[model samples]
Target chain A: MSTILIIEQVLNGLQFGVMLFLMAAGLTLIFGVMGLINLAHGSLYMVGAFAAAAVAGATGSFFLGLVAALAAAALAGAVIEMVVIRRLYAAPHLDQVLATFALILIFSEGTRWVFGSFPLFLDIPVGLAGPVTLPGGIEYPLYRLALIGIGLAVGLGLWALIERTRIGIQIRAGENDREMIAALGVDISKLYTLIFALGAALAGLAGALVGAIQSVQVGMGEPVLILAFVVIVIGGIGSIRGAFIGALLVGLTDTLGGVFLPELFKLFMETGAAQKSGSAIASMAIYILMGLVLVWRPTGLFGARG
Target chain B: MKRFLMAAAATALGASSAAADIKVGMITTLSGGGAGLGIDVRDGFMLAISQSGRDDIEVVIEDDQRKPDIAVQLSDKMIQSERVDVMTGIIWSNLAMAVVPAAVNQNVFYLSPNAGPSPLAGKGCHQNYFNVAWQNDNLHEAAGAHANGAGYSNTFILAPNYPAGTDALTGYKRFYEGELAGEVYTKLGQTDYAAELAQIRASGADSVFFFLPGGMGISFLKQYANSGIDLPVVGPAFSFDQGILQAVGDAALGVVNTSQWNKDIDNPTNAAFVESFQAEFGRLPSLYASQGFDTANLLISALEAADPSDADAFREALRAADFDSTRGDFAFGPNHHPVQTIYAREVIKEGDVFTNKIIGTALENHSDAYAADCKM
Candidate 1:
């Protein structure tokens, strides 16, 4: 590949990685603070995209749509936490999985009922509609570049929130010992609700931002949800730093593997067969990376718990 | 107790009307990512049956959920329990492969509204199976012919890696008569096209051909539009259909696509179908809907000739293909696949609506390559 193409691919990988961090951050935070496996995280992502699409279509304002997405997803997350998730805090992981899985179905069917089965239209805003030139004469989509910037800004803001605030201290304490934090002045239930809603808002924001480029449809979140899970597993289940690093690693591996694997196979195999086998391997590249990570460090690159 | 009583009464009604009744079980994706296509097909089929005002035709529709195993189970239930004499409404080729052969083997007449995989069109062809839609390769082959007509000598091709995807590339290459700059098989259901678009940009190709259907297509078109590659794009109609064109927005505008039917086809049946479809469903009919309409009309024509229980006569009646299709001239090849004209359609925005208009005929009197392999 040419230097320019490789540079472009790296940029694409970073863009993808940054988006994954947005998703993985929330998932890891919820698991860390709440000690609950929220399988309905993807549903929240869908809710955000749908909310954004609906508002954007009605008001013809992308900014207002994003605000609606955050509000709607956070509201849904808070409501779900209070109504359904609260009951399952002490339940087994299996029960939590079943309940959240049900939520995915409900959210999917509910979104389909409201939005209809057809994918809703959500485009990049007019100001960021086309590509822009970068250093060394590389042309990249302005919206995607903005996405990377926004994702990194969110990441930095999240770090500040967690590291420099009293709420952050309480959240970290909860991750360590929930009973101890509850024993203190903290109202643990309210804290849990806040954390869940916050995490959900992050997922929603990611959904709305990505929805501009991707499809805004039912079950859109599930695929990204899978990737987010892989990210958390590789980054360490409850570590934001780990999630960030893992997200970038997975994204780069996926994008680069997809581009190079087929070419690599073509050197040894026929063109068609090489393409097929290369794509097949590329699809499994992230999982294989996870496997290698686990083999090397079972706890993950940044995971604390065994 | 009320439910049980209702079931008994329905069974009694079914028994009483058994002589002249034709039961059709439609198994299709209705509740997931690919639900739009299935919903359109079901709407079109039901519309035709409703317009016919035939109480004798009992249609049982079930959502396949785009799962092959579920389709197989539904087909079994329809055959054994519901005792449906005819089956239709499968959208995907893999699902058709899962359900069609077994249904036809059990003597249930199969009328495919979409998804005519080459296996059923060739070596696996059965007397009871008929495809109202074009063969899976038909539109892609036509797209290739259109590309040649457009004078594209170097092209970049990509498709999701599956049987249908492989078939799409093969079909394009069969008539393309051009040097391929690059050919890539993308992961099925892949949403991102950044890597592929980069490859396309650097491939030095004059045009791009892709065959990502449903949501995948929506994602590809959106990303490709923003990628600044600006290469001309051509593909089969699945991406540019009425059900999805709105979601694609302006990114799909002026892009040429190939299909066996379009709303602008100059035919009385097509015009009426489009007008009434919008009136009934409050939306334009897609190509899948047209296929469903034609399938239902084909079944109606056969029912007019003879009962489906008489396998020989019903099969012949269906083979006669005497229904007025939305695509105008329509017939069945030796393999029971559609022999029809495939058109080149340009996506155009009328007001706020994104729809296709027929630009030219890509292929006339088109029959699938697999037809020659069918002995029957």
Candidate 2:
């Protein structure tokens, strides 16, 4: 491949990785602080996508649609947190998983009921509709480039929130000792809701951003949800930094493996054989990487031991 | 709610002991990922029956949830418990492969509206199974024919790594005599196409042909447009069907796709069907919808000819294919697959709606390649 092609693929990887980080950050944050496995996280992502698509189609404004997505998903997260998730907070992980899984069905069916089974259209804004030429005569989609920037900004912003702010300190403290914080007059339930809403907002933002290029439809979040789980698992269960790094690793591996594995295999094997085996391995590359990581560090790359 | 109504209608009908109530069981995906296609098929079939006001037919509709095992279970229940005389309305090829064999084996006539897998057209073909839609390979073969006629020498092909995908590529290769620049298979339901686009960009291919139905096609076409790839793209009509064309929108405009039916087909039956469907559903009918409408009318006409109780008469009536099809002049091949016209449709923006207009005929009186394999 040429340098320009490689650069383009790298950017694609970064763009994909950024979206994954948006999803993984929220999931990891929830699991870290609340210790509840949220299987419905993907449903929240779908909610954001549908909301954005609907608003955008109605108003013909991408930014307005995005804001709506953030608002809708946060509201949904907060509402569910208070109503259903709050009850599951004291329950076992299995119970939490089952409850969230049930939420997935409700959200999926409910979205279908509202939006119908067909996919909705969401166009890229006129300003970002086309490609921009990059350095070394490379061309890339401006919207995707914007995604990378947003991901980095969000990553830095999350770091500041967790490390440099008072709420961040309280959150960190809650993660360490919830009972101590509660005894110290910190409203743990409200804090949990805020955190859940914050995570939901991030996922919503991700969904809105990706929906421009992908069909905004039911079950859109499912594949992304599975990938986000893989990202968090590899990054460590509760670490944003780990999630960030892990997300990038996965995006790069998946993007590059899919592009190059077959080509690389072709150098040593016949055409048909290379294409078949290369894709088979490429599809399994991330899982294989996970297995190797688990063998080395059971908790994950940055996971802490209980 | 629809199922409840159907059940209630059947119960009220059962009280009459009319014996003319030809129990028609339709098992299709009504929920989950591919629900849109199945919903269209169901609506179109029901529309035809409802428009005719035929109380002699009792249609039982069930959702398969797009699972093979569930489809198999529903097939057994519909065949044994419901004791349905005829069964139809499966959308996916795999589900058809799973349920068609057992349903037909039990002597239940299976009328396919959407999926027409090649196996069912070949040695596995049954006298009781009739495919109203084009065989899975027909549209792809038409696509290949279109590409060859357009004079594309180096083409890149991509499809999901499944049986239908394999059939799609094989069908294209069967007609198109060209040098393949590259071939690739992607994961089913994969939304990302960045890697594949990159390969398409680098492969020195002059054109691209792909078969990714539903959301997969939308994702690929949208990404391909965004990536600034300027290759000529063609594929079967599934990706360009009415349900998803709006999502693909401007990216799909000007792209050619092959189909067995289009709204613009010049026929009285098609004109009436389209007008009535639009009035009933407040949306233009898709190819799947047309197939469903035709399948329902076919069954209705057969019912008019002979009762479902007479196996030989009913099979012969269905094989005659005397009903007016939306595609016009449609007949069944020896293997019971549709021998009909395949049209090339170009995605065009009609006002604000994204829909297809007929460009040209790709195949006329086309019969599936595997029909000769059937001994019966």
Q: Give the TM-scores of the predictions, in the order they appear.
A: 0.98, 0.97
Predicted candidate 1 versus true structure: per-residue lDDT over A156-178, tens digit per residue: 99999999999999999999999
Per-candidate DockQ values are 0.87, 0.72
Residue B36, model 1, lDDT: 94
For the predicted complex of model 1, DockQ is 0.87
Q: Pick the candidate with the highest lDDT.
A: 1
Q: How much lDDT does candidate 2 score? A: 0.91
Off-target runs (Cα >4 Å) in candidate 1 are: B1-20
| Segments of candidate 2 deviating more than 4 angstroms | B1-20
Clashing pairs in 1: A236-A303
Q: Per-residue error at A296 for model 1, in Å?
A: 0.8
**Total clashing pairs for each candidate:** 1, 0
